[model samples]
Target: MLRVMNERAVFGEIFRLGKVSRPELAQATGLSKPTISMALADLERARLVRPIGLRTGNAGRAALLYEIRPEAGWVLAVDVGREFVRLALADLVGDIAARGDERRKGGETPAELVARLGELTRELADEAGAALEDITLTVFGTPGIHDKETGSLQLAPNLPGWERPGAIELLAGVVPDTPYIVENDVDLAAVGEGAYGLGQGVDHFALVWIGTGIGMGVVIDGKLYRGAQGAAGEISYLPVGEGDPLVNRGRGMLESVASADGVVAQAARLGLEGLTSAKDVFDAARRQDPIACQVVAAESDHIAHALAGVIAVLDPELVVLGGGIGVQAGDLLIGPVTGRLRDLVALRVPMIKASTLGTEAVLLGAMAVGLTTARDLVFERAVAQAPPG
Candidate 1:
């Protein structure tokens, strides 16, 4: 029951050369002129492809070339973190039309957060000259493990009381009938980077985020490699130190040394006052403050040590540094981490780079998920509306 000829004409031409003319599609797909014409017409009508321009270099007649349409429908992406929530409205080509952020106050309930998201989404849609209903789908990236079977946040350390019944269901209820997806923030960021940013064209890579907490996302062969329990890259629990009370108790080893809060707390213990946040420490380091510089250097070294283990195990081609703290001090961390890694590994060294997307990576990734979902939905509709075989 497959429309083999039609699908071949469309996908074969698109994937082979990224763009194609009708005659070229016909030639490559081995379809008759009439069949190619009919298929292209249907695809254009569905807004899957659009005329780019007329091609030159022909003696007799010029051929009109076509490209994939990136704005058939909009995608909404949300990145929910412990301190703030960032939202973006993007087209199919991954262009953000409108963006905004809101600070998260302590003790905010899930229903309250969902209502705020609805309000902000409505505002953003209006700013982008788009309607809420026009958005094909929505994806949310939060610091939590989502249970797909029940649509619940199984384990979210940052958001207290966020796993109650109907959390995702209630959020979906706000925008009636709109498709919604929920995923871990780090995983979404990795996907975003791989699809549209630094990880583009690279197959195997690791994205490590150093912020309120330390976490990672692994990509293998161009796809997110979530382990069997959907917690593959949760590296915060890796044991590094032994017999130390602070290192062995509560949060895991990597988080105690590499996270922003961990750095700040360590700085305080070292008699450094007025360093209330990671940004303060970074600024102090920029100002040539010795204590702040030492703190950041120590944290970077710890992260590098942890990454050495990851490299020994996964052998990724690239390691991407991200998150608020990571992006802010990428220059400082990259050199030290790379140096420490060299000491630990003897073989080929992986390219260590900073994330180009910054804090927006997770949001953009969520949008990618939404756009892909919309595309799949459209394909399903086309299949259902096809003529009986």
Candidate 2:
């Protein structure tokens, strides 16, 4: 039993850009006027759509305009990173109504983090004047491999104790009854960029985030292509540098040269110290510090070298650089990376750009995942309750 009637109402509201009369819906869906009226009434009762004034195109006679209710149901999105947790509440239309971020100690367990997230979600819902019950879905993006089958976080090197027992189970217990989804942080950022930012129009693009570590998300044919076992875009392991044989090999490949730690390690090899993190190096580069300039230049060269391989293989239409370091470095990275790419590939360079969403990309992506999940759930429920053919 497909809830054909409910599906019609949702589709009508989704496709209706302006004031769409019942006559128009009848024509579009090929349903009778009575059926359209019934669907609209049901949607109104669900608070999913409402009349919004009238349309004026038929000889001074106004027909009613209907719109999908943005606040009918909400989504709670959380981005749990190594150093911070960002939470946001968003409507069906992807507008953030409330947001907050908090820094964390390096070794906090998932249970501790889940408790913090529960508090923030409730606080955000209160600020938006909505009840927790109004949240139809919850999605989180974190730094790790998310095992969909077991719904667990596995092997996040940056967070100690993240892989311990009951991490995902505990978080689920906290946000009970809500549909929960978890994904790698970088993957979510790519989804966010595709849905709401620069990657919207491009079908093929690469989102590379260079920060404490290097991770990438690849989009092909307008979809996030998470490979089998969800390890498709783990570019950090791509080998690129010289260090202790075993330590260098164990660090994987790409992380050795392009990640924030990679840059710091490179600086240390040159006997540079007193540098706190990649941000310090970037700030110094801005101020034209000689050591900073040299360090950044060398790191940029490595990043570009890696990007050239991605371009040659993926041939994406755009490469979006994000994360704190990528956003700040901008064309400083583009020049060297693209230059290296140009030398490797015979084809013209793809458009290289910065993420407009900044650090909020993963949060926004979680919202999108939640919204889509909710919509699908609504459809599934409708089908289950539909009358037997």
Candidate 3:
């Protein structure tokens, strides 16, 4: 048991330092030379870590450097959104081996969608020169709350068959051992920001997605906070916005007034002609159309009211505006939203910023989430390969 623990520690060090020498591992892990040697031998035998090169130019004999084998584990990240389904396969070292992005044709059943996903996964695996079973873990970044007990996705009205009882189960069978996860797309976006975007190093923050749908993903103390029922940041249900909250009870209050559809509805109600989408409204606002500007203001007010509620409850250190409308018109919305947010809140205002990653946020976040699980699973498998331990 001690030997296995030592091997894991050494493997962790090598994983962290990229490539490390035995003596360096010894110093880093505070283990003696023989212990480092044993750990390296175990890891090498398991094909988890290997000597990449030599640490030369030293005072004494050169030391061999080791690194985690990049092919030892694989992660498949899927972004199942309203319009697109994206798949990416990455190796242990975070190199994307292959990727597929396709616009989802409207009206496919859950089973058909799962079949399409399977076909894509197999194609990408072949493209990457990896077998179908090589995927160690799969993470699906999708909208709505996934119920573990029932294995059903809740509140995902955008994807028709996704909320069905057996829909998400099919995703797990894409890889070996049925190792997979279905996480809220917005929550995964928060993870992506922490890994590669604006929320990096932020201990507490929220990724507010205002687009075709409205939602928020909260990260507290560097961990995604899925509330008791795993619906922590369903800010769309917020009741603080204008108009009757029950008017769009099916879609929630804030979502009804602040989502893309809401923006378009506001444009029409405010007398803006022929703007079918929020994108058009924002473009018209940029072109200085008076009614469109008023629509933007109305949208901003609705969003501000919703955000004020979020701030009062969560008190995140920062808020990152994301999704289609949030990213495209974020610059426009940020100023007005911030101004309104300032007036609406009594506490110190959190910094508001636009997502740097744009559409890739959820996909990247799924990778991050998968990597977290893959790391542990891979490490345990490697440790298990040690002789007599």
Number of the predicted model whose TM-score against the real structure is largest: 3
Query: Which segments of candidate 3 are over 4 A away from where they belong?
Result: 57-61, 242-249
Compared with the true structure, what per-residue lDDT tens digits does model 2 show for residues 101-165? 98976676767777778888889999988888778788888887877666567758766666765
Among these predictions, the greatest lDDT belongs to 3
Clashing pairs in 2: 237-253, 237-254, 238-253, 238-254, 239-253
User: In candidate 3, what are the lDDT values of residues 1-106, reduced to their tens digit?
Assistant: 7887898788778877888888888899999999899889888889988888888887989988888898999999999998899999999888999989999996
Q: How far out, in Å, is residue 14 in model 3? A: 2.0
CA error at residue 377 for candidate 1, angstroms: 1.2
Backbone atom clashes (below 3 Å) for every candidate:
0, 5, 0
Given candidate 1, what's the lDDT at residue 337?
Answer: 82
- 74, model 2: CA deviation in Å? 1.4
lDDT by residue (1-389, candidate 1, tens digit) is: 33544764575376346568888887888887788777777767666668899999979789888776766667889888988999999875556889989998857888888889899999999998888887878898988678766767865767766777656687685466888888899999999899888999999999998888778999999999989878888888777532223332456677876677777877886778987888898888889889988987888778877887899989999999999888898877888889888888876779999999998889877877776787666545555665655
Better model by lDDT, 1 or 3? 3
In candidate 1, position 129 carries an lDDT of 87
